[model samples]
Target: MIPAQFDYVAPGTVADAVAALIDGGEDAKVLAGGQSLIPVLRLRLSYPSLLVDLRKIDELRGVREDGAELVIGAMTRHADVISDPLVRQHAALLAEAAATVADPAVRHRGTFGGSLAHADPAGDLPAVAVALGAQLVAEGPGGRRSIAAADFFQDYLQTALAPDEVLVEVRLPKLQGRWGVAYEKFSRTAQAWAIVGVAAAVRRDNGAIAEARIGLTNMGSTPVRAGAVEAALAGASAEAGTIAEAAAHAADGTHAPSDLSGGSDYREHLARVLTRRAVTTAAGL
Candidate 1:
């Protein structure tokens, strides 16, 4: 299917991109890697008056270190993200989750920021971002500001980004010490969206779990933090039984959706099961 005609502009700078978006008004759409938006356009689901492409914005396409945090450009490809030394060293959960995003070809073209900005609850990265307590940076006509990953996603296919703002980068605190991370996902196929996914990051102290962060994918309208599970695992024994017990609370505050993939009950079950696996692995038990 052919998309409705739309004017397109490739901006070399974020300032220019912002200007273009503002000039295009409410009908403007930002094109990153086009991994998700292109299909919507082709199906006529979105009829934008203009497309502000950011491919030429070189600043938004790399990984760098800033004090205790790692800064990732919004336009960094999934492949680059998975292989970047800074990402692997500081935020292994991100690389682990990015490795599971579709196939090699899609990963090569999908932008890290694009996936998060797309705000699909089923996407793998948002869960990891939430689990890592990452910060999303956006620039607009007003100025630049940071949005917590927990607040960045609002609902299904929705985000906190203003219409005139462009996501510039993401900041992740470096995980130091005895930290183990894992991302466990249940999908019908390698390229299919997750029916349920769990991102776990555990920090072990001595023989106990000192801290644990758990994020649930497709468990609600947005990526949900497994607060119940995290609380249950705090200072708990880093053993399989203890982890499994905490995993039982995986669905405590979630509102899982029922779809063709599976029923809500089934997803909740998967969440518990996968959370146990992810936490156990992360705890090194």
Candidate 2:
């Protein structure tokens, strides 16, 4: 289906983009890679009167390091993310997850901010973002504000972005210690959205888990941290038995949906199973 007619403006700077967004008001929508928004437009799920294209905003591209943080511009493509040597070495979980985002074609055009802003429960980027304790930087006419990953996602398909703001970049803290990270996804076929996905980071000290962060995808309305598992993994063995015991609470406090791909109970089971496997893989067990 064809999309509703809309005025288009390509902003040259972040300030211009925010001004356009505010001027366009609620009837305007920001355009990133267009991989997600274009479909919504074509399906008439969104009918914004104006489209603010962010492709030319130079400030919204590339990656840089600031002290202990790795700042990734919102417009950075998933493909770039996966291949970036810096990201691979320091933020391997993100690189791994991006490599699995709907194959190469989609990743080539989809922006990291677009995926996270879209807030799709099954989207790989958001899960990785949450797991890494990333921070989103949003700029508006009012000024810039930094939002933590835990506070950015509000509900299914909902985020905390204000109408006049544009997400500029995501800030991730540098991985510390002898950390092992893994991204595990379960899909029916290549390019299929994950039925269940897990992103795990484990820090080992003397072969014992010093710290762990696990994020579950497609297991809730928003990507959720496996706190129970993290708590259980602390001071515990990184062996299979212990991992399984902690991962038992993987589905706790999640509002996972049942769909044709799987049912509620099935998703819960997957959450547990995948979390265990991902943590194990990260531990190199």
Candidate 3:
């Protein structure tokens, strides 16, 4: 498959890119890693009049610590995220989840912000972002603004980023104390999209679970927080039985889909089982 004719520009500056996007209007599309958009273009699913490339923008590529938060530039590669010591040390769940995105080649080419902006519910990063309560930074004609992870994804293949906006960076809160984290992904094969994925970050206090944050992938139209499971786990014993009992509520508020991998009911069941594993592992129980 081949894409239709389109004008392309690789802007060296964020302002220039935004200007191009504003000029191109509704027919313009921004190109980041191209892992998702290229496929769409080749299939002729989208025919943008202009494509704004952001790869050469130096400011949009790196990982650094800002006060208590770790700021990751939008253009940082998944491979970089996996290897960056700052990310590995401060936000282990993100690194662990990024490692599961496609295979090595995709990880090498895919950008962190690209995946989040693509807003694919099955994508590994979105659930992790939601789980970690990450903040997405977007720059548009109106300067800049931050969107909370819980409010970023609007629906399947949709996000809260406006058409004129480009996601610039992601701010992740540092894990404070006694925190254990794990990502549990269930796929038909290695590198395949997860049928059901769970990202868990649990804080332990004494011999019980102090607080737990759980994010679900492919459980709804968007990556969703497992609020029911989290509520059930608060102050619960770290025993396997207690964790398993709480994990049974993983699907309590989700609206999973029926796809080739499994039926909706099957996904709900996997959510329960995987949630237990993720929570238990993250709790170090």
Among the numbered candidates, top lDDT falls to 1
What would the per-residue lDDT of candidate 3 be over residues 209-276, giving only the tens digit for each residue? 99999999999989999999999999998999999999999999899999899999999999999999
Write one digit per residue (lDDT tens) for candidate 1, span 1-285.
Answer: 999999999999999999999999999999999989998999999999999999999999999999999999999999999999989899999999999998999898999999999999999999999999999999999999999999999999999999999999999989988899999999998789999999999999999999999999999999999999999999998888899899999999799999999999999999999999999999988
**Better by lDDT, candidate 3 or 1:** 1
Write one digit per residue (lDDT tens) for candidate 2, span 1-285: 999999999989999999899899899999999998999999999899999999998888888899899999999999998888778878999998998999788888999999999999999889899999999999988889999999998888899998888999999998988999988899999999999899999999897899999998988888989888889998788798988898898888877889999998999899898988899998889
Clashes of each: 0, 0, 0
As a TM-score, model 1 comes out at 0.99
Worst 10 residues of 3 by lDDT: 276-285
Candidate 2: worst 10 consecutive residues by lDDT?
Answer: 81-90
lDDT of 1 at 166: 99
Global lDDT for candidate 1?
A: 0.96
| Candidate 1 runs further than 4 Å off | none
